[model samples]
Target chain A: MEKQVILDPQQFDLTVTRLCHELLEQHADFSNSVLIGLQPRGIHLVSRMLDKLQEILPTPPICGNLDITFHRDDFRRREIPLIPSVTNIDFSIENKKVILVDDVLYTGRTIRSGLDALLTFGRPIQVQLLVLIDRRFKRDLPIQADYIGKSVDTLNHERVKVSWKNIDGEDRVELYIKQTHE
Target chain B: MSSLSVDHLLGIRNLSVDDIERIFQTAQSFKEVINRPIKKVPSLRDITLANVFFENSTRTRLSFELAAKRLSADVINFTASNSSVKKGETLIDTVNNIIAMKVDMVVLRHASPGAASFLSKHTKAKIINAGDGTHEHPTQALLDAFSLREKLGELNGKRIAIIGDILHSRVALSNIYCLQKLGAEVLVCGPSSLIPKGIDSLGVKVSHDLTETLLWCDAANFLRIQLERQDSPFFPSLRDYALQFGLTSEIMESLNKSIIVMHPGPINRGVEISSSVADSSDSIILDQVENGVAIRMAVIYLLAAQIER
Candidate 1:
């Protein structure tokens, strides 16, 4: 029943600037690297990062969006009519260093699905995961993010919500207790 | 409608309009999956599907088998041509034996009607009726309707004339139910004898004139004359039938406006529809075949997902 703000708009902007500098330090040219945003939610983060990466570098890299809806492990656990989002990766991801961007890292199942979904485009030379809010030690799969904005330890019942300025009129991260039927 | 209550896709009638939409919505996902470079997913890796076909088929069996494989399920193909069914085993025993092997689902095509509906009562595995005797080809109807919606958006109030052997078509029967459910005006056009009695009672208009019907429709789905399934003469001859009802270029061109052409193939090219019209731009006949895999995948994925609940 309680909610707490973790990162406000100013802190989030500074975090993005640091991440951009770290990314520029490693992959200076941004030629062989490509960024992919996991669909339905990661799209917002991908757009922000792509914009930020362009500002931080001379050349912005190729970016695409992927939907891992069909690749999910729990399709059978849910009801019928699981609506699929659009996957709009026009160019090939072949042999590129792929960076998967997402809003949160929870069970790592979404990242697993995203990895599987990425294989469809072509086998990438290397794949890395990036999350704005990494919920540490909460993985059902053995996936760990290579680049994390902030690592926060939390209870299984708590939810991490990432909001964007374009979407929720503010850039912020919050923690809340996920409500379930009693 | 929330989830498919029936456990098996025995017929389109078993699904509500909402269920059909859900299936299409799910199919949209699989359609995207196949377009990917790997074209496979591990969602059904733990699930095994036994395609127990009791009749000769090419497209339907291949499509379902591909669908299962694409979903990363183990596929065990049991055709009547090479099965114990040829050695005097009953349908129930053969399928139950497969299910006993821990097969999670069965995609069936039987010569007898209600084979899937019958088998679902005995087996713990989920069932998907690929096709049954003049009964229903649920996936075909689903793909056909899906292809239609994909080609021309919003099926509500769209006119679709299903032209050809209605009396012998499981496709026609299923399409009528499916199309009508989506709020499309359906017209069944064929030879008088080929038209089943009291078909209009299903709330579809009946027409013997193909041109008249084609002109009235935004989409015309041509059913191949089911020569293989015919026991006795329903019409006088193929030539006479083609003369009266064949969809030629002239007939098609006369309509002035483009109508979406569809066929549940193995098309009798010059009989029901001319070769020209079959290969026409507006024809989504091949798209239906490609969409068949995605539709079957959606059907299996949804059915297998709901076995426990």
Candidate 2:
């Protein structure tokens, strides 16, 4: 097994700043748009994005936290049980632009579940995906992110993990490679 | 699903504390699933369930049916009146016929005690006991605990007084089994004759005095007194029973502490609980009914996880 550090603490901060700026470029006033962070892992990423968005705009629109555990495709196929997080979308998503935020985009199955779960609140005029890490050439679905912080090419046996400062004690991106033959 | 001890949910007696926690945790997820706009999930897709009710019921049967349907499982319902049970067919024979049709699970409500467990041994399909005759209603107790946890946060060290006819109550037996497992102190309060013999041996306090029990408890579950089940008089008369045990607003105010009020269903109104006390904010009878679906769904999902085919 091997490990690769794609982004250090300084690089991760820059990526967060750039992604927040990219978000503000499309949604300037945020009048008809709202931010939603996918549940469990995405909640931390969304709060970080919100902290960055607050620097640009004094008052940001309400943010939603969505749980896609029940809507996932491999619910029965998986060996481990799925525990669902809370879906805290107080405001309606009707006819509003929604940006779904997550930490990583790999097989795109999570994003697909998020998309299915998002419609349960209300029909959105437009929907976009924002991820901190984009694992290239390994999508089980045809979905693509509208906003991405960094894209990395990895093998099928490789795993991309985004660590947060609060949870994991530091901010960084690392890839774990399995050494089956070596 | 990782540590689920039993393949079938026959009673709370066989369930470990971890199994109860797992069921409650899974029910919490299913509760969230029902709040969605689509109101349906495909988790139980390709699974089939049959609801076999050999006894009369309203809430438990419908709750199990709705829970199965919400999980996207194909459901077929059978009642004693409409089925061959009326023609003297045995329980195993009737259930085996349904299992032969490739049904995955069975939610059964029978007047005979241990009917689900008996069927579980004879048939390959998983069995869930909605309610057995004076035995244990596992799902009912789970939902009651779920509702109590919602109101009181957790069951640990909480005092719960289950008041009414314990002799005939499947609910009391099951609730005692579950609440004790969840670390709640249980008190069985009822008329001396109405309280079952040896109920005190199950690690719960038994008392006929209502005020003393109410003062010592945080929640009170007033079980319906089945007049039909009492062939010989347990109490002197209805008026005597009501005067002694009926929960009134005056009794509620005398407690001087906030307490949760719960009842199974089909309330006798002025008999067991007065209208004022039953309609008060403390009464979570409706929440108990709603959580029934989620609890049943959790039981089915966890049990089905162990099914090989």
Candidate 3:
């Protein structure tokens, strides 16, 4: 496998700051607007964004973690079972403008499942998607992210990996390309 | 491991400590799912389940049905009294008939010891032994252990006493296997007649004294005296049995340290345990019932994920 650094630590912080600025411009003060982080990986990015946003804004919006394992389309279609994570939304999302956050936007199935999971809490006035990295042309569903930090084009055999400073001890995005053996 | 080692949950003996831990972990997630506003998930939406009870059941049947429905699975219920088993239909034929209708799983409760094992060999659907005579009630034991672990942090080095009928109650046997496998010490306390032969060979201490056994353990699981399974008198009388073995409030007051009380109900109120003690804060009988749904959901979800698409 061939590894290539897509975003270094300095660029990663700048991208998060730019994304939070875009969110502040649109949702202005974030009143009646909430952010929901997809579980396992998305929560890391969401918490980082929340920390950056709170530095400038007076009030932070209600943020929660949502797990979509039970709402996935591929329930029995896989070889192994999908383990669920903790969904810790304590407040209501009724008639709120909800932004669904994730680390990477891949096949768009996770967002689709997230949409279904979000409805179980309550109906939202509007729902939008946010991602740190968007893999262009790899979507299997008719879904798109409203906010994107960076968009990269790649082949299906290549992968995108995101690391956090708190978790992986560094903030970096790397692309892993499978080497051909022919 | 993501999946269970055995496809069918026939008994606790077939499950390893890893399998039990996985079940408890999955159940912790489902417990949150059920407490939500919707109280349902779509994991098993395309699958169909059949509750095939050859014997009578009220709680177990309702628990299984609710668990299946909560996962968004279609369910069909069958009871022996109303089914073709009365017309001489064999167990395989009944199960095969259900499987012919595209049922993916069978939750079975029969009076025979190995009826679940028998159906698993003859039928094509996955089998979950709801209760197989005096053999095993694996799900009940799972929920009981799950509830106990919730009240108590872990089962390692914890002392648990199984009180009351051991010969006729399948719950006791399943609990013994489950609690012991989780590293808890077990002691079966009852009259010599009700205690089965060679129970000590299962590696659990046997005692006839209730107070001494309760004093020795951290938790006491009092079982219901099954009069339906008793062919002849195992003890002198219900009054005599209550006087000797029943968990009364006086016994609760006598114990220096408070012990957790548990009962797998349709509790024989005032027979094996008094009503006050069963309803006490230390008693987790109702939590066991609530955990039953989540445990069954985890079991079915894990097994259904392994089914060939």
For lDDT, the strongest prediction is 3
Instruction: Give the alpha carbon lDDT tens digit for every residue of B198-225 in model 3.
Output: 9989999999999999889988999999
DockQ, 0 to 1 scale, candidate 1: 0.52
Give the native contact fraction of candidate 3.
0.64
- Taking all chains together, each candidate's TM-score versus the true structure is 0.93, 0.96, 0.97
Docking model 2 quality class: medium
Top of the candidates by DockQ: 3
What is candidate 2's TM-score against the reference?
0.96
The total number of steric clashes, by the backbone 3 Å criterion, in model 3 comes to 0
Model 1: how far residue A142 lies from native, Å: 4.7
TM-score ranking, high to low = 3, 2, 1
Model 1, stretches more than 4 Å misplaced?
A54-60, A73-83, A137-142, A177-182
The single-chain TM-score for chain B of candidate 1 is: 0.97
Candidate 2 lDDT over residue span B1-309, tens digit each: 383788899999999998999889989888877776767777778789999998889998899999999888899999889878778899999999998999999999988898888988999898999888999999999999999999999899999999999999999999999999999999999898988888778999998999999999999999999876788998898889999998999999988898899999889999999999899998998889889889888888788777774
lDDT of 3: 0.93
Where is model 2 more than 4 Å wrong at Cα?
A: B1-3
Candidate achieving the largest TM-score: 3
Worst-scoring 10-residue span by lDDT in model 3 chain B: B1-10
* CAPRI quality level assigned to candidate 3 from its DockQ score: medium
